[model samples]
Target chain A: PAPDSAAQGLALARNGQLTKPPGALGRLEDLAIWLAGWQGREKPQASAPQVVIFAANHGIAARGVSAFPPQVTAQMVANFRHGGAAINQLSRTFGASLGVHALDLDQPTADFTQGPAMTEAEVVSALATGWNAVDPEADLLVTGEMGIGNTTSAAAIAAALLGGNAQDWVGRGTGVDDHGLARKAETVRAGLVAHADALHDPLEVLRRLGGREIAAMTGAIARARMERVAVVLDGFICCAAALVLQRLHEGALDHCIAGHVSAEAGHGRLLAALGKDPLLALGLRLGEGSGAALALGVVQGAIACHSGMATFAEAGVSGA
Target chain B: PAPDSAAQGLALARNGQLTKPPGALGRLEDLAIWLAGWQGREKPQASAPQVVIFAANHGIAARGVSAFPPQVTAQMVANFRHGGAAINQLSRTFGASLGVHALDLDQPTADFTQGPAMTEAEVVSALATGWNAVDPEADLLVTGEMGIGNTTSAAAIAAALLGGNAQDWVGRGTGVDDHGLARKAETVRAGLVAHADALHDPLEVLRRLGGREIAAMTGAIARARMERVAVVLDGFICCAAALVLQRLHEGALDHCIAGHVSAEAGHGRLLAALGKDPLLALGLRLGEGSGAALALGVVQGAIACHSGMATFAEAGVSGA
Candidate 1:
């Protein structure tokens, strides 16, 4: 479904009469109008916002690309279940409903350097997990991921779709040292070379060079668009997943806003390619939907001001 | 009272052992530790945050330095009183206590282009209004302003304290035109020249070239510091107020963090001078503490993550 132009028009009209100078609210004004258009309401609200976290083990972890071992993915999933991760805290802070899904944690995706990271059937299952995870009642959605060696996969996907070398897209994930960073870049290069033929199709890129968690994010975002849930995309790996959808369909991410550009090396370039100006930029590099979860507060604030503020006539304030 | 070094040390130690990589949260980590230091708790929270808005009328508006008429200041104060303003909505969104102090809005200050903006006694009254408005129970504080043509006064104060010409500080405030901007620069230059001898003293400069609202912000910030409440200073006008305190006493703003750098031309330079790094930079120029109120969400999220996340040992997650 397309955005409601009528609702957007009304929102713009209301924004002008809110008593402050025109455009004084800056990007917040845009955020409110965008939400209004997507929610198809002149006064849209994300009263039931949702955040989903996908966890999967990556076979690429064997290549020494990440600082932490892959087993930490499962451990952190348990932490999330215990309400003990950063995302869990953030979800509570912003009143977001939290869900975590682990896709075959015991069966790691195949290393992309050797072949496709996942078979077609396996990729389909991962996509279904994400698609099924979104709540119909949710007015806003945020997706995050947990996989130690996923940065290598994300870098591969970005480079494959966006015409960048391994160096341009690679960065230290999970605090990898300089030597480990070189190893990650080399792994990205190998993965891209191994799947050069399959890379033309975006879904193939997801299966060949992306992890289950990444694939899940891609599917969840698509589901949000279908559900008319305005989405706030997370940091680097999350944006890489979104880029896959972007290449696959025009306006696939029209419902989405980049929550924040991560400190990751490729994120700024990726956001530029996607033409997204992020909401927050505190140099955060942590994933698990933390950035987007944090950004939910900003969106809610924008919506509240748009919906709850008084017009010049209502307040009896003189306007320009 | 000084920040508790012991609390900050404990916070730093706790941050090191959190589930994510070291410093993955970037400036948020600094925010949390800073909060802990001021709140004197290893796991501090801003459960009772307060936002104070100081509204006043500036005589400088008569010079055509602002796009809006002088009456807009009093009208906006009424708008705030009726809860129709942006700050009201933001306070409700973030669970902050909102206080609006219109410091004699019917009494426009003397135009600094010809003479001092306020008498010493008048400045003291405004400061006391701000100082008394702060809730002692507030764990976090944000101060903002509303005054047509206050930007001219703010620019004049920044120029006086930080050594810059009018051109370096002047910008389009409330959608000023090219001619209005030129007029603003001229007003600031005239104000600076009119009070050149008293410019060496920060408080004297505040009385001579600053508004009651600006003085009130300076008082509120000082009050927050005395109460050991962490402060998030707002845009150019707010920063200029904090700068008076910064110049009057060394490390006066150590308890403060810049909320956001406004789109105003002098704000980035002001932040640079204060040696403060802003939390958000969304190009927001709204002065009703909107930027600081929005940033309260960011600060709250950072504290939630810092205080609530399990340590690696507790989560049983492997660490680097």
Candidate 2:
């Protein structure tokens, strides 16, 4: 669907709901109603909201963009398995099923070693692997990426795909200081220059500098389109994946909803290019689907308002 | 606690968690961690989050600051009983038990009459009623008010408590137009003049113009202080009640957690007087404990992080 057509659906959902007057439900109500129209139903239902965690090692970690060592990636994955990560807590809270996929981007299989980011083919395959892991019947999919120093990867990808200086879109990831950020920015710039021609293609750029997790998220978004599953994006990193998918298929964006805006610099540019608004702004920079998880309640509130709120006719109240 | 004291607790919660590094959980994680310390427990628990709704008639409703007629106050109360209002939906979704109480201020409780704005005796009675309504032991209590033309009442209370201009604090409640707003402002000014002597005695002022609900909420906040329960505040209106409680018992401020900052102009003054910072700012003006309901999850998240997240000691992760 083009932007106009998708917006029309949103408008219809906003108007025809059986609840309170138009826009009474606020933004969440708007989303639920929009999703209802997208699903072509009056009572849009979400049984299982799936959160896909894409994990890959970033080569830029060597540039000291992150306070923790790159080994934290694999370690966090193990932690995820043990259900100790933030995402794990959010998954339980939101009742969203969590799927953790490791993108073996030629880094250490069990520890950490630096290498070129996953090849383009590897990126696509890793995404496919994660996307395939989802039950196609899942009501909605929220994509989150987990990779040490991946902020550097995201900045490079955004610069190449959206056309900008890498330094502007980049920010301190994992609490790196000013000097560390400078080095990280320089490293990202070099990666962009080295892969400029390949950067002409979003997939090519992702493969060149994006970690396995990002590629996996791109694949997940693509698969979501194929399966007609709506994708709720978490912060700047995941939006990078959505941008790649938008290039592949403009209609793919119809399935995307930005959960919240990040303090990260590039997120605004990506959101603008995609022509979408981030629903919440709490100055969150942490990834791992925490923002997306918070947005789930908003979405749920929307659904409840649309499905449960009494209209003027039903509640016998006057409407403006 | 001072800002730095709260910040220290946040720093602890941000760090020493098993999954992510310090600041990895973002602002929410820091908040949750801070709340745990307030509870005096490493892991805080929130089994029952309570929202007490106070319904009263405002003297300003006579001035016409609202699109809806004042009769809508009792109508909304009926709607609430039937569980058809937005607040009803929110309390249900957030799993926070809700209590609605009517404070009688010598106004006609007759079928057509709006309500009793409190009298000092009525204020004391309403607070007593509200105090008795809650569990002797509860984790958190949220105080919210519902009334037509309540923003005018709130602005007046804020002005009286904080010594600000009523016009400066007043806003368009329920969508009043410019002419209606001017009338509303005039109404606030007239009410201020009419009640100046009574307002000089805060309790007397509350009895004169504060609706039964505002009086009840003030009592509930005072009760929360006595019971040592955390009180989550919504917006300007709620903050006005909080200010009264703060005036009545200075320690009452300790139990409050500013839930969300309102787009309401007076909220800034009210929050400043209370010496609190709101956790979220979503441009919300819907006053049915909607802001507090949203904050419920954050409070729960804070308690959960303290209780559930594995410490570095437990997970055997290296400290920074």
Candidate 3:
């Protein structure tokens, strides 16, 4: 949905009269006006935020492209279930409901370097799974992912979609050593070469080089826009999914907010391509929706200031 | 008191056992370690946060340096009390206790361009008042300020302490016009010249040019460190206060975190001089503690990740 320009104008006018100097709130005022436009209300309400963590295992893990073993994906999922992961704690802190979904828990994708990561049918199924994960009742939706060697898949997809070199796209996933980074880069380069012809199609790119979690996140973002729910994109992998979604569906990112700039090498470039500014930059690289959850507070702050703060007239104060 | 190096080491060792890759959490892990050292606990808690907003009127308002009038200071203070200000909403969202203190409500300082801003006795009284504002039981302390034309005062003080020219230090406060900005710069330059001889002394510099809120914030930061409470310094004016506190008492910044790099011109230099990395960089220039209140969430997220996350052994996951 397009943002309501009328409401945005009203919000901007109100901001100017809010007893502070013009633009004193800086980017915060901009965020509030953006939220007002999306919510289609002069005073938008940010409540009942929900975060979903899509967990999957990547076939690229077998290529020694990640520092942690592929089995850690399931282990971290269990950790999330037991409320022992960073995302779990963050969700609790932000008062958001946490959902952990193993989109391909029992079925890992084929190694992208060897062939396609997932079949077209599997990609469609994963997208459906992600689409179904969006809750109708939630006002805000945040997307996070848990997958080992997924960064390698994300790099290939990003390289194909954003027209970047594999080496430039690749980063040390899970803090890999030099050898592991080299292997990861080589694997991503090989996958891009294998899928070069089909890379023009967003779904083909996902099927050929992206993991189930990325596909699911893409679906989640698309569905969030359809449902008029605000989306918060997490980090590098998540932004890669958003890139694919934005390519497939124009204006998909209108409902989305980039949560943070991840420590990953290509995350900043990905955010720039997507045309979104992150709210926080604490050098966070954790990808279990932790950054998204942390950003909920900032989003809420923007909403609170936009809707709840008194205007100059209401406060009987002079304007700038 | 110095940070507990033993606790920091223990926290670092524990971070290695977390289920994620080593350093995957990035600066969040570092923030947790810093909190551990300050809290003197391997698992530092970020509960019971408090934000104190020091409200006063700056003498430099007479120079027409600010976009907003001096009367807006007391009006915004009323807004804070009525829960209508940005800081109030942020405090409510973050669940931090809000303290609004009118340090010199009945006593506006003199124009520093012509003469000293405050008397030695008034500065001493303001410092003690700020000292008394600290809550003994609070775990985290955030300092914010509200004073019209305070930015000009902050610029003068920063130029004097950090040894920079007024052109490098001056910024448009509350979205000033180009003419107002030029006037502000000229006023700051004149004040710096007037107080050049006494600028070597930190307290004398504060007395000659700094607003009461700055003095109070300096005192609050010192007192918070003495009470072993972590301080989150908001924006440029607050950073100026921190500069004075650091100069007056060495190691005062050990308990402080730069909340965000303000849009003010000299804030980056100020943070660099203090050797602090801000948690957020949202281009916030709103005073009255809004940035610091937003940062409480980030600080809490770090603490939550540190203490609540499951170790590799505990989660039955293999290490990288």
lDDT of 3: 0.86
B-chain TM-score, every candidate? 0.98, 0.87, 0.97
For all the predictions, what are the DockQ values?
0.83, 0.36, 0.75
How well does candidate 2 reproduce the true complex, by DockQ?
0.36
Error of 1 at B189 (Å): 1.4
Best by lDDT: 1
lDDT (tens digit, per residue) of candidate 2 on A74-122: 7777777788777777767667899888777346221112334664466
Tell me the spans in candidate 3 whose CA falls farther than 4 Å from its real position: none
Q: Which RMSD values do the candidates have, in order?
A: 1.1, 4.0, 1.5
Which regions of candidate 1 fall more than 4 Å away from where they truly are? none
* Tens digits of per-residue lDDT for model 1, A1-320: 78899999999999988878888888889999999999999999966799999999999899999999889999999999999999999999899999999999999999889999999999999999999999977879999999889888899999999987899999987789999999998999998889889878999999999989999999899988888888998988999999999999888889999899889888999998888999888888989999999999889889889999999889887776
Candidate 3 has what TM-score?
0.97
Q: What value does the lDDT take at residue B155 in candidate 2?
A: 77
| Candidate 3 chain B weakest ten by summed lDDT | B18-27
Lowest-scoring 10 consecutive residues by lDDT in candidate 1 chain A?
A311-320
State which candidate, 1 or 3, has the greater DockQ: 1
Per-residue CA lDDT of model 2 for B1-320, tens digit only, reads: 32235544654754556555666556665566555555555455675888777776766666667777776666666666777766776676667788887655336222112232554466677778778877656778887777777787777777766676768888766667788888767766766776676566777656665666766777787777666677789987888877887777676587678888877767876787888877766566768777777777666655554456666666655454
Q: Which one is best on TM-score?
A: 1
TM-scores across all candidates?
A: 0.98, 0.89, 0.97
